[model samples]
Target chain A: MTRPGGRSARVRDAVHEAVVELLAAGEIDAAIPKIAERAGVNPTSIYRRWGSRDHLLLDAAVTRLRAKSPIPDTGSLRDDLLGWAEGVERSMRDRRGQILLRALVATMAPDEEPVEYLRARGDDLQNALDRAAARGEPVPTVDEVLDFVLAPLYLRVLFRRPVEPGTAARLVGRLLTALPADPAPRAGRGG
Target chain B: MTRPGGRSARVRDAVHEAVVELLAAGEIDAAIPKIAERAGVNPTSIYRRWGSRDHLLLDAAVTRLRAKSPIPDTGSLRDDLLGWAEGVERSMRDRRGQILLRALVATMAPDEEPVEYLRARGDDLQNALDRAAARGEPVPTVDEVLDFVLAPLYLRVLFRRPVEPGTAARLVGRLLTALPADPAPRAGRGG
Candidate 1:
């Protein structure tokens, strides 16, 4: 693991924190110099790290969101999916997370920011999927999860639907029933 | 049947057509006067009919999109679903439909506009769902169709995914399997 006390790691945490704070304060177009000043890091370091202000904003939002909700490693695929769904529900409910979700929604149109932000978010979902597959568990494909789980979460986000407690469970249940790991019967299995 | 050639009906048609044209031409903020001019109608009549500019825009977009797609009544739940899915795919593929979809997505925030715009669109889905039930066929709940079929279709709209012919069939297949009209067997049935 990267050294937690390292200056570089501390700087990254500070910069990301500043980005979220500024975004919450409605500084969606906050300049890099402002972010650097808020984070107490050199502008040069931020530019070298993220290449551009937009990149840094997207990175901060996604990185922090992912960090807060690491993909679950529950032994059961059902539990794993439920955990993943709850984490997404929690993320969108957060004030900062709402800002991030809006940011992602804004990029739904063509020629906005590059889609790498969404693609990078896909990696988190993939990590959960790969974990299920590695344990010889049936796993839904990435697209299925997106369609069944993520789509509903985001649709709720789109509609400003209040997140109910059982929302994630219901979504995961539907996904499990629809796209079972290996839907076919196993010939070698005996009762 | 309603009179299609009535003066009021003609006015409504012209105004809706004008709204869609203006939206596609990148005049998202086109005022009522502009819309009236484009439709070759009086501004007073536009306000008299729609009451407000925002109302007119929402009414026009939803009306035109719904008009272009009358809900399918193919006499079978499966085919009806397939037809409904294909209609959604076709709508989002259309240039004007894309504009209206973007308009809807932009309202994903807390206070962008009324949720009635989306609710009106939801009526289209309900029409198909209602049709299935009226025929004594098993049917998925509104949420099931939203999560399974409509979610993926709209997700493609969000992600700019290409429209594949099998996309609707695939989505409908999963929905049918996941949420059958009656998953349990009848008490008694003779062949």
Candidate 2:
């Protein structure tokens, strides 16, 4: 299906596609003229629209990375956590995803949208935690969720280490073990 | 005090110092000839000795980053972990340290020594865990140590977020809470 958008939107999409293709080809050091040539767009327009190569790359890359990992609530925190972790691993395994994540790691600044991009990616984990609490299961803090689940995954990606099979399940098991043995009454309420 | 090393050693030291200085100055993309010139060393000699720019920067940076944070067994895992966290935070806060870390993140490849450099940095944490086990404390696994302690600190570093005061203690407290309630006898013996 053709995407319904204005001419400018179409141009943007073309440019983004070019960015992804070039980045996927491992042309991380590709200049603006190269990207514009690949996109068949004007170099001035590309520079005027994106301002910097970093911004252009980040915009396209963040869209790709975030697009692949939509967390579905499977009605079980274990399932949800596993799904999230698996999605992360799958993204990391993709060449485009690898380029994007590495570029994000290398070029990300505190002021950049990638910071917000990363924080938004945490929503699925947060949702899972909230669901667990709602069901009276042991709920972990946001910090715990980040450290126990997300951090290890990102570390593996950063190091280009293959996230071994069963890693997610093991992480979830550890999270469960970390919870209080005797579930406190109404523990999830107000926490 | 006069250094006892020979001429080659002195040349290596000067080159390494130049690496740190250039990295700290945020000249991350600086060329090899520039670095050699800055170090007052012959460019050919520099290339022959260090093999590549990345190696030179990593050798110097890893030495500095690791040398400062020697995690001593402080009789309590909490104290030890807290000390380690604080050391990491301190290193990250330093301008020179910040540049080194950024360059490392940028230039790091899966096959590079920085990967080993990072893994080796975890030895201190592993040592702390072993000490905890020896004392019959509810010891965590290497994964737990990486996730619980190192990950959060690294996340902050990666995002350029300030590691707020008390963050380290809070992380330690959470890790302690996550441990089994009744410690097993001689937990470290068989494992």
Candidate 3:
């Protein structure tokens, strides 16, 4: 599909892929001129496409991350949470994901754009949990469930600890068994 | 009390207070010479005391943070968790605390000593939780409880929204109520 802008999807994809490659290779501190040269595009074209280095890098990193793995739904809330945790754990273990997370954290300096992106990503995960809860899963609030399951995985990542096997499964199981049933009929209110 | 190191505690306090003032004034990126000037000390003396710029900054920040607050203990585990969360939220709202958190996250890359200091701080919080749990609190595991309660506060600080009033309190109440009784005291291996 053609974007509103004149740039074709294919061209945008190519630029994004180039950006991902550069970031994965640990050239995050490289100059925009270097990025343009690596992407084989004129500096003006690159600027026109992404506006700023931070914007381009954030877009490319988030796009690559979304493409890495899908958050799974395995017909059970427990399984789904476990699967999602496992995916996050694996991503943290991968070098590219680590670099991307660090970059994102470094860039979040009480700014509007980064804050908006973070909130949107969090809402995306929260939406998935909402869907599960609507399907009559035993979890109460998406926020609580997410915090209970994902926080430890992130702790391990930030602290450089080995992601223990079955840790995700155990966390999911405990949360599932312990969470109180939704008190009211779940419909449109995405917790 | 007089120390063996020849420098008085008063001198150390003065230097640390100067560092905090510099950081609070958003001058952390200033040169060591400038910091020494601000502290009314020779650069060599500052170096002799703290070894390096990173060491000086970290020690000063840590001291300020530790001095500004004590870990919460509200008798009930739920109240304690909520209190701790509220304290975290307040810190995130403060300018100095925000800078400190950003500084810690920035130092997480390929820097061993700083990362070790960060981990020790987290471990200290976990130890506090352990002590709370040992006092007949109903939380199942210290690791799980700490991850669920505190990690989300950090996530909020790093990403997502600034913590809202009572968000932490509500989350703590939900989690505490949801937690199951500690598994029947495990018996030693049977004969």
Per-model TM-score versus the true fold: 0.78, 0.80, 0.79
DockQ of 1: 0.28
For candidate 1, write residues B1-191 as lDDT tens digits.
14478898899989988988887887877899999999999999999988987778767766766665555778887887787777877886776786776666653444453254556656666777677677777777666677777777766666555556677778888888775556343322110
Q: Write the per-residue lDDT of candidate 3 for residues B44-80, one digit (tens) a residue.
A: 8888988877777777766665544445666666666
Alpha-carbon RMSD, each predicted model: 6.3, 4.8, 5.0
The deviation in Å at residue A159 for candidate 1 is 2.4
Q: List model 3 lDDT by residue over A1-191, tens digit each.
A: 12456556666777777776776776767767888787777888878978988887777767665555346667766666676767766776677776676676666554343355544445555666667767866554555555666666665555455566777776677567665665354443232
Ranked by lDDT, the better of candidates 2 and 3 is 2
DockQ for model 3 equals 0.36
lDDT (Cα, tens digit) per residue for candidate 2, span A3-119? 569988878888988988887776778899998999899999998999999889877877667667766688887777778777767777666677777777776752343245465
Candidate 2 lands at a TM-score of 0.80
Clashing pairs in 1: A138-A181, B138-B181
| Highest-scoring model, lDDT | 1
Task: Select the stronger candidate by lDDT from 1 and 3.
Answer: 1
lDDT of 2 at A55: 84
In order, what DockQ does each candidate have?
0.28, 0.36, 0.36
